[model samples]
Target chain A: MNDLMIKASDVGKAFGDRQALDGVSIAVPRGTVLGLLGHNGAGKTTLVNVLTTMLPPDRGTAEVAGFDVVREAHQVRSRIGLTGQFAAVDEGLSGLDNLVLIARLLGASTREARARAAELLELFDLVDAAKRPSRTYSGGMRRRLDLAASLVGHPEVIFLDEPTTGLDPAARLGLWEVVERLVTDGTTVLLTTQYLDEADRLADSITVLAQGRVVATGTSAELKAQVGQRSVTVTLADRSDLPKAQEALERAGLHPVPAADTLTAPVTSSRELAVVVRALDEVGLEATELALGEPTLDDVYLTLAAHAA
Target chain B: MTTTLTAPRTRWRGTDVFTQVLVLTQRSLRTLVSDPRMIVFSVLQPLVMLTLFSQIFASIANTPGFPTGVSYIDFLMPAILVNTAIQSALQAGVGLVTDMKNGVLARFRSLPIRVGSVLVARSLSDLVRTAAQLVLMMLFAIVIFGFSPAGGVGGVLAALALSLAVGWGLGWVFLAIASWLRNAELMQTVGFLAMFPLMFASSAYVPVGALPGWLQAVANVNPLTYAVDAARALCLAHPVTGVVSALTISAALGLVGWVFAVRGFRRPL
Candidate 1:
């Protein structure tokens, strides 16, 4: 039982002349989630492929569950599960059969395989449609089955590549809940997603990959603190009150930036909320609307993306 | 329902490679059984071709240099059989390309099983399909066109076996090509482009001597010719030269194809 379930050092991969991954490295501790965030062609999937043993890196090294991905791929494979961006369950086989086949491949007896398949179907809420061909399943159900198929072997580490990319909101939440449960039970996970909110909610730490390189890595809060801003927006009833509101906030030691019929100011503490009200009231202006905004991961992402560009 | 939170196993007992390949092969076979329309269509296409060729080539028997007493249908049955096997083998490659495009190969690669088993299972499944299709083609030829093998039942079985060997061997070749291309449309185009040349230049349809000097040279070197010639000898109860030579070539070519296919499979998708 290694504490670091995954470790890669300066792994590089190229397809022909195009370098898909350039000196990327990642490590995930047991029972935690590491979200790899990147846009398309940013090498998120390529990195997952390398870690899952589906592809060998051209340079450097990677290990999963303490086994070298190249020399000891079989051992690494046995301990890891992977749910790719597309649902990889067999389209020709029924959901139940797909799960059972994977179980049998993992060395389960026929009886045990059946039991595991039944249990997984129930867990994924796919029992009702288990006997139907997976090609007939809706996108969400197929994704669920693909996830269930990977879990049949009870892998110690799971790679989920854009698991919720095409899923509807409800289905996305369902998958997130399932992943959360897995992590709570000591399963280490490396999740790659395009959705910042998904990583913000589910990941313990986030790694941003841009053009085949890691641009940033930290907890969501830490990332926001680095490049994100907190602000309070005040909307006045009269357009003429804008200049007054701006001067009031600036005179009160707060810098308020003005927009059309409204003003936005950076706030470092909650005390600024009271300061804003008192300053605006003293200036003989009554506000119509007020809002306090915390810096979101989206802002952090945009800032980092701009810097990288 | 309560979800189990069992701790992950440190290291489970690994299944042997044979069992893994068998399991995957069984899965492929199950898909074949479930798709009745594909099976029916696959068998029907060859039967229809057999009928068309037997009727269309009825005058080839009168061509003097054609076998003295053999009907054109009998001489042509072996060619059609070998052609059908080759065509069916191409389907295996098409399936592999489809699997790669849809990420099915990625899923299989992530498993604990030997990676080579995936290609082996696909080739095995195609071998079985090719054998079944050949048997049906033979039966239909026997009843409809009065086709008969002079070497009796054993020779027919041996001929059938050779057709399957060609199927198995070429199935690997197609698999290798498909894995390398990783595109179904591209693989299909390449397969057909490659297939027409191989089948037409072979001695499957006409005697090598009857072909022009240059085409005769090509047929002499083509492996499909040995296979069709072998089957023809078996059906006519002729000397076994073609049979022995065809089997030797098939084994050697099959070995080469498997090596290339496995190497292609091991490459990154």
Candidate 2:
């Protein structure tokens, strides 16, 4: 509890008849990134709101940076920064003005605020577009500015709610790099994203939410190992060789599923590749292509989603 | 590279509410002035009203019950100021709704600042905007129409101050509405519905005595009527009869509005 930057226990929230978050618990330690992955309406934003002190949970408690969210909300707020699902910058003001306004709100003097704003603009590579209204900024520039605005207070903990939801691939990668730099600087982060690749790359640990419940939680490799499988697929040179290839693989104690001209078999080890080769040779069958594949985070996500459904 | 995360966690000493309000008011004012077209249109509406009403109703000044020595422009100018104040006050609500919709207010909420500061800053900024517009409209009335109030510069200044106070008071009402509704389009529709009747059915267009009996009752009870009537008296150098009632009503409305606005704003978005 002392080392944890964010901790929530049995948190619950509801809106009328729909439960937005129910009995959800998560703990993120200091100086690490916790990736929260969920589908739309899967209670991602609701949990972010609760932990960031924007909304009080209907049941249970949450603590951020050692302050109880409900009882010591201002203390929690002072130590945390939040970049909401939207850019959340004042579109009518220039990027510089937006950062300056936040800095001043956080009790920085005008000179200090300007200095901090300039530093963040430089860090985020937004110095060139700093004088323009955020409304005129590209989506990526706007997001960078929003993130910079959140960084003005040098908060120990940050909550980024779907930070790259609408960004292009390059922009998403740029933001991921920024998060990596922040984590290196010892800032704890709770990032919510829909992209599994994003989670796999950035998260020290991932929590998958489904219908206001924690469906799964683990590291990327651990999750992939849970539902993911390694396999070998062989494409036949001739369409007529599919049946022979299937029979040859079955004789080697491998169950092959044939689709089109390819036979795919789940394998426990890489030695099964030689087994497949020798089996094909014994049947006098020639293969066009043979490839081994590793399970990806996508498989883990799909399997979890299917099970949750 | 400046590393911030390892920096010592400073104990939270509460930020001054006044400073927070001032900082946010500057932000609101910056957004207001950044768009020249919005400023132009804000004054344009009253300029159009001044042109249409002063010309069309110029004959009313010569009628039997009309004030003998005052031109229609002089009497109409003060009422137009009050009307502009009402419109500007409604804009305060619209501005809050826009912030709420665009997520800026959410950012403010997640910060450590006092919640009431947002409402206060909104009202203060809109009051400043209304002041600028009123000054420009007054200059237009004096220069373009060659209109001079009988009460002179001091009287006109007093009327301007009264209109600003009234506008600031009325702004709280709309701010409360904005906090409760949290929808820009709905705020506009409701604003129009409320403002249209309040502006026309009061003493803004004509004297209460000149109105029909039913509308006269409305004009009598309407707080805006007192505001308009007081402003008209100050501009026309009358005995200043309506000042007490106008100030009292504005204070009462402001008190009620502040309570509700703060309550609504403090609730979860």
Candidate 3:
């Protein structure tokens, strides 16, 4: 019931000459998800490693579930479960056996371990394939089994490192639903991912990392707002009318950028949708398609990437 | 799913380290059991070597100063037994490296279990496997090669115990190296590189006098030579100071290796 289940303060780690994490600090409150967004080698996994006590920070301190990760690693470890980018379950063992082994290691009795394994198999939709070796399982199935393994001990906080990185859309949604359920039941989560939409949908707040530093941290709406505003996109009836449309929009104090046949301009609000219509009408042009589009996480990501570069 | 109680909370209970090590040992033994072919092949290689070497070196017993009381196979059996045990110990390092490479060791580290359990469990299970291989080789020496020791079955059992002790000690040394290297091929290369000299310079195949001046010096101090000499003495029904020294060295090596192995586990991956 701690308010902040995970907190890192000025954490720094370096490998050889390269800094994998530099002054990276993040706080994840209880019963909330902190979505870590970053490009490859952006220290997302490195941060996860530090928080989970897999690696200690070179300069600063990190704590999970109120236990200092380096000094009280055992306590931190017992409270947090980590599912890496790749499934780390024992592939040679059956899914059931894998869960049972984890449960047993977590201090469950033999009978309790069997019961818990059976229960997790059903919950993860892996009951039918429970008896089959995980090596034979599909990618999605193996991923679920890995998640199930982590949950065998009912960890208070879960660190999912790109949990849905390679899953099909359906599998990703299924996994997301499982995560949503866990959060609803009050489990803290720190999820690192390459998918912006996954963060937008699942995260209570997002922290964007670039070059091992926190470039931005906010709610999805806040991040999107920081990048820009809701925009109006216009598609003209004639393809050659693109320049005229762009000029008309620009003349009305709108910044227009042409992408293929469409011209889009950022607007402070949906009220500018009328300005777009009026400008086009004043130029004696008709629009085939005109719509106001809200700024998405993708725009925020692109803007961050541009700023970092 | 509804019937299941997903508390979504950590109980924070602690399991004893002894139970954790025992559970992990069970896992290692289970994996070893599942791969019967590996065990069979491991034992088979020593059987082949024993047979080939006994036949090839039978003529060496006719040399002027060779031990007169026993067939060449009797002397060679103790050497092969030690060799087999050393070979089996290599598996400990290889298994640890494989575990590290596959992230299984990482998974274990993430848990609340004791850090040393992984190495201790591997060494324990390997000791059992090496013991089985030693016994199988001893039976082959007795039945197929017409080999008989003056010390009888008790002496044979004593030799088996000594070989296993030596192998267990060496296995920890390799496991320590594996934790640092985290590469199976590299571990095997280093282990064999070190093992060859130890085996070749030891009193396994011949007396220390049969070696050259420098090698005789090396063979005199080689730990494997003491182990083989002790086992050979036991088999000849005249257990000597060599037996006491061998057991003491094995115990000491096991302790030192264990400390290094645990320290290796404590180091970051």
How do the candidates rank by TM-score, highest first? 2, 1, 3
Q: How does each model score on lDDT?
A: 0.84, 0.87, 0.84
Model 2 interface DockQ: 0.38
**Model 3 per-residue lDDT tens digits across residues A190-228:** 999987789999999999987789989999888877767
Q: Residue pairs in steric clash, candidate 3?
A: none
Q: Write the per-residue lDDT of candidate 1 for residues A161-241, one digit (tens) a residue.
A: 999988999999999999999998799999999877899899999998877888789987776666546667899889887
Docking class of 3: acceptable
- Of the candidates shown, which would achieve the greatest DockQ relative to the real structure? 1
The weakest ten consecutive residues by lDDT in model 1 chain B span: B5-14
Locate the minimum summed-lDDT window of 10 residues in model 2 chain B.
B5-14
* lDDT score for residue B195 of model 3: 91
Q: Give one digit per residue, the lDDT tens place, for model 3 in B119-208.
A: 888888888889878888888888899879787888888888888888888888888787788788898899889998899898888777
DockQ per model, Cα: 0.43, 0.38, 0.34
- Model 2 CA deviation exceeding 4 Å by range: A230-309, B1-14
Local lDDT at B141 for model 1: 86
